[model samples]
Target: MEWRWNAVFLVSFGVVWAAMTTAKPVSSLDPADAETRMLAALEDQYAHDPGNAVLARSLAETYLDLGRPGLAIAALRAGDPANLENPMVAHRLAQAYEASGRVLDAYATADLALARCARALGTADAPSGTPVPRFACDARQHMALSTHQEALGHMLEWGIADPARDARTEVAYDLALRRASIASAR
Candidate 1:
């Protein structure tokens, strides 16, 4: 009876070990290979839902991850213009623009996204006791911070002083600060 119990335990352990070894963790894949696989999956989804804003945005992000900012821009542009108002879409587009060295465009896109976020949050004078929502303000602040960081990154990449870079950075910092203050006020 003891031997029979031992045999069952060994078989169960072997099955568990086989399952573990057969199922590879996604993190174990090479970064490049994983990215390629993700891009292919995103592309397949996009093909099935050509007008899907979410899929388009995800595809653009994957392209950006693959260091193909130009393709990211194209993918984003191909999506419905109405979806551009989505803060996430706008933010990703700005990132792609920044990656492609279009600093002004990136700043403008980021600014537009921030504005949309603010608008979504309702007017600034919205009742004194009203609870301030979190997501839009936080997203706006993130977009501003990202724009500022991207500007600095571009400056470092180009190895040259851009007169507008400082101005953009200042504006971004101010925007971020304002957003944070608003959040705190609530």
Candidate 2:
């Protein structure tokens, strides 16, 4: 799913880049020198190797940098990112949608990206035979920890947490109880 979206984003972004180069401001020489240069370069690239994906991605990123969010997103969307809804793609798509004044779509994409991140974080630490997926500790362990819990874990683990004013202390204690409950349940 993620790979598919990555490809679409790459392509859409590439074409947008090529277009941006062509769409550069007017030049003095022959009036169309910039256009010609842009086209020639794009054509040269397209002709040299239709299978040059790196070039294509570079072109797409270039388009994104040229303030042509529409073209860049389109190029990227042409691949799996549009269909797959990966977090990175969702993040970019949200950006593009926001730039295009599509507030709702932007919000939606942002939400999806957040959800994907959360989901990934949740299932990252699964024990081999546990009823529920385990949390990965120390960034290497994958666990479905809540935001507060995760913060608490990091603070406690690192010993930098202030006992007097930390909101996460209670959260950590609650999580401990929950873990105990789960252990007993199992």
Candidate 3:
């Protein structure tokens, strides 16, 4: 009995000591470090697939989330300029521009996104037999209002007195509000 007790105590102490030496405390792990590592991984992926809109968008979005809007803009621009079929890519680029204090760029990008959104939602005229699929339209519709609002905000903040500013701003805000209502109903 005495020998068994001594063996168990030794085993327990050894286990405790191993755990203490091997395990890091949860609080000691830096979240920023993890985020930086993830950003690096994303950059590697983007480098390998520069033409991939989804990968580029993800990388740019991650950079934007990390408060590195310049990096985000660079990622978005790395893709083909004419291949912004994914409206959200343009939307994210617009957001990065806004965050980086490039209001004019933001307005232009958001306007481009809005046009893509319109086409995706079937609001733009197309061949009579070809309508946008319901699911596809629904997927893109959610972002329409936000994109319009972004455009309007950027235009307002551009601080230039264009002759068409009043009409354009009104139209943008009206569309944004109308889309918001439509979105809420869904």
Candidate 4:
């Protein structure tokens, strides 16, 4: 039921990601050379600031853009514990795992990312007219929720029941998905 809506969201998200990745910028330099330069810069930046969540995320994204999910996974994993717990990093790591054909790992990581997002956003509901968080929390939460739903769908498809499943989580996720859908439609 809810999973059907989740499936639609996941497929749309994947299509957007694929389209974005495939769209090359019109540049005087060769596209490959530009991407290579961007990758080199990201690697250097990440090397200097391994604990920086933003750098780690950027490095992982670059690796993924270059179709090297293995490198992306390594980049995401080789960071500070606090940084590694970042929802965005976890989201990217899950994507990397999926790209590399590691379905179980991807599902686990997406679940973790969803948990991290819930923690970051807190349990207390915001007032109806409250301003959105300043740190891109909305986008982070959306990414985490969509990825987890997608991964959970995959697990069910594979006949695996997640041992971590709970009724509370399912209800919360459904509400969150509804809110996200409403927000996006605005």
On lDDT, the leading prediction is 4
Per-candidate count of clashing residue pairs (backbone under 3 Å): 0, 27, 0, 0
As a TM-score, model 3 comes out at: 0.59
Task: Please rank every candidate by TM-score, starting with the best.
Answer: 3, 4, 1, 2
Whole-model alpha-carbon lDDT for candidate 3 = 0.67
Cα lDDT tens digits for candidate 3, 48-162: 8787777877987888776789888887887666436566777788778767767677777777666656666666332335344222334445366354545456456646334
TM-score of 2: 0.37
Q: TM per model?
A: 0.54, 0.37, 0.59, 0.58
Better of 1 and 2 by lDDT: 1
Location of the lowest summed lDDT over 10 successive residues in candidate 3: 126-135
Off by over 4 Å in 1: 1-34, 123-186
Q: Which ten residues in a row have the lowest lDDT in candidate 1?
A: 125-134
Q: Write the per-residue lDDT of candidate 2 for residues 23-59, one digit (tens) a residue.
A: 8566433535785477458646744654444444554
As for candidate 4, its clashing pairs are none
lDDT of 4 by residue, 72-119 (tens): 998877777667567778788887886676767877887766655655
